[model samples]
Target: MKLAYFYRNLNQGGIQKMIVNAANYFVEQGNDVSVVLMIPGGEYVSLLDPRIKLIYFRSLKKSRLFFSFSDILKREKFDVLFTATPSLNTFTVIGRLMARVKTKIVISERNNTVVFFKNSALTLSKLTFLSIPLLYRFADAIVAVSKGLGQSLQKVALIPANKIHVIYNPAWSPELEKQAGLPVQHEWLNDDTVPVLITVGRLVDAKNHALLIDAIALLSKKREVRLIIIGEGPLREKLQSQINSLNLQDCISLEGFKLNPVSWMSKANLFVLSSDYEGFGNVLVEALAAGLTIVSTDCDYGPAEILEDRYGFLVPIGQVNALSEQINYALDHPIDRDLLISRAREFSVNQIMQHYQSLFSTLIS
Candidate 1:
């Protein structure tokens, strides 16, 4: 099958990572894979599989993407097209028609559509996202990364239940072990005596890192556990201010972005998330794979799905006390390392690839 993935760019986000990972997986399986990006440059361009073709319709602004992308689709004539996010998904529907191609278009809702549109920062975003119900019907299939997200998509996108299916992202790969084995620079990460807690993601309002800071501050009163926050964003100065004001300078260290975060996860005793919303908790799965005990807010779309059964514990979103208590419990009562790794394998690349392959096969057959 000649498969193409349409995305905004090669940016360093969970969706982009999945697109690149899936494209590579398809290529490895002897299918021709092409990554179609609206923009040309991103940090993750280097991470993509060399066997996969990268088609970047560069210098094309929003107003012009439809025309430019349709031209490429007509020429490339991929057997199937996978698009994530509303903007690209909507465009894929238009592009396919404009190109008059026979490609099976699979629209993937990467985030909890309801919560996303509800919390959209701009009026235009909210209005644009509301159009999903109308545009998505043209696609060959609709995918939600989690069952929770699938339900949300059905409700928010106003799509019928039969139109949606759940497919967990390929969060774990065989290569992850090699990446986890990569040497980390931080001394405290591997130090068992430190009792470290780790969280990864951009410092953003949606991530609600401030809540995590507050929870850690609550824990610091009675214990000496440390925190390693990976990734950078605009919230650095604000988060730093909160840490300084709380006199938590010694307990929390914003390590910024580490290319190989699994190395840090490899040593951390616990993984935490205080996000108010999540598309899918990719890092939670990564933490499980790294054998870290997990505690996160029972936030919409992802945390509860990730924490189902005994894999981890989920506290209600924005509840500092509950989050703090769960963190403390995970610290004291450790989950079995083998069990965490085993559960993580449920979302391994091979498993997710099969689900995607099933979709492609169905379309071709």
Candidate 2:
């Protein structure tokens, strides 16, 4: 099988990581795999399995990139073209048509489309929202990371229910446990006296890191707790200011992005997610793999499904008080380590890859 993944860049985001994992998995399974990028490079570009080919359209301009992408499809005509995110998915659909390729197009929706359009301020977002109904019908299959997101896509885009398949992300890789075992020499993680709470995501508006900071402040008021936010983004300075303003500089630290956040998760006492929304909370599964107790916002599409109330606790989104209170409660009563580890196995990379292979095979057959 010749499989190719299309994305803007191979950044460290959850979607990008899933693509890298899938590409690696398929290539190892003896399939020829290629990663097609519109933008030339990203941090995750180095993480690709050496066996997988890296193809770049290499243009900052959308029109040039689109034409370049179509040309590749016309020339290569891969067995399957798997694309993530709305922008790239749209391009793959229209580009395949223009190129007159017989490639089976599989588009993965990694966010709640309704929430995405509602929160987005960009004009391009509006255009993409409009294009979904017009473009996505051409794709061979549509994969939503969560059932909530699958339903949301149906409502928002008017996509046929039968066209959508709910496939969870490949979150638990063998490397996750291996990385978790690696030495992490952070003061907060090293100190057993103070409880350390960790969260991982880009410091973007949807992540609502500010709300997490406020919750940490509230959690600190009652007892000693420390928070390590482990991703970098645009809101870093603003979040730092918020930390300084609330005198939480000592308790909260924005440790930027670490390639192996599992190392930190393995040592942390608790894992917290304060996202306004998510396609699926990958970090939560990583935490579960690390045997850490979790407190996540019951945001659209992912957390509730992942945690399922039985695995971990979920609070309403953006409710600082509720988030803080739940964090405190979760700390008091942690879930069983063995149970959490057991649950994490369901999302192992090998298992998720089988579902993807099944979809691709069905399309080709």
Candidate 3:
């Protein structure tokens, strides 16, 4: 089978990592795989498999992106292709129609479509939301990263229920485990004597990182602990301000994006997710895979599904008080690391690749 995957870039993001991993896995299975990028050059570009073909559509002008992808697909003639992101899905749908590409197009939804629209600042997202029901219905299949996310997209985007499929994100691999064992030269994480709480994601508004900072302050009142945020974004200055105002400058470290966060995860006492919404929380799975205890907000879509049945603790989103309490509880009572890791294996590369293999096999046949 010839498979093509599309995304905006290979930026330091979970979705990009997942695409790279899946592409690598499929190619190893003897399928012809090509990864298409709208714009090239990102932290994760080096992570792509050497066996898989990579194509980049450089944009001298942003308006031409739609036709650029269409032109590529028309020529490649893949058996099936996958795309995620709302605006790009809209583009992919129209591109397939205009290009008359024979490939079965599968578009994945990566956020709570309704909650995402509620927090959206982009006009592109609004336009894409309007096109979801209309354009997405034309795709071979629509994948949501979680069950709640799928239902939300179906109801809010007016996409037919039958058209939506739930596919949880896969966790890390042996390569990640080896990376986890590598040395991390951080002063705060140097010693396990102090409680260390770690969180990984872009420093964005939707991530509700400000709430994490506030929760850290609330947690500090009870005991001594350090906070490590392992991603960078537009809100860094604002988050730094929040940390300074609380005089948490000493305890909280805004460690900007790292190519391999598995090292930090290896040493942390606990992992956290403070997002207001997520299609699925990939970092939580990474933490679990590392055998780290976790306390995450039971946000709109993902965390609860991941933490259910005592696997981990889930607090209400944006509630500093609740988040504070959950963190303290996790610190006080440690979960069985082996069991936590056991749960994470359910979403391992082998398990998830089989899911995609089935989906693609059905679609191409």
Candidate 1: regions farther than 4 A off: none
lDDT of each: 0.86, 0.90, 0.87
Q: What residue pairs are clashing in model 1? A: none
Task: Report the C-alpha lDDT of model 1 over 1-365, residue by residue, as the tens digit.
Answer: 99998888876678877887898889999999999887887777888888889898845776887889888888898999999888778878988988898999999987766666777789878777877778888989999998888887877778899879799999998777677777777778757787999999888888899999999999988788999899888899999999999999988999886666888898888999888988788888888888888988888778777779798888889899888888988899989988988888888888889999998899888
* lDDT comparison, 1 vs 2, better candidate: 2
lDDT of 1 at 187: 77
Model 2 residue 12 lDDT score: 75
Sort the predicted structures by lDDT, highest score first.
2, 3, 1
Give one digit per residue, the lDDT tens place, for model 2 in 1-365: 99999888887799888988899999999998999987778888888999999888845575586688888888787999999888888878888988888999999899878888878899998899899988988899999999999998897668889999999999998788888899987898889999999999999999999999998888898999999999989999999999999999899999998888999999999999999999998998999999999999999979999889689998999899999999999998999998998888899999999999999999988
* Candidate 3 accuracy as lDDT: 0.87
For each of the candidates, give the backbone clash count: 0, 0, 0
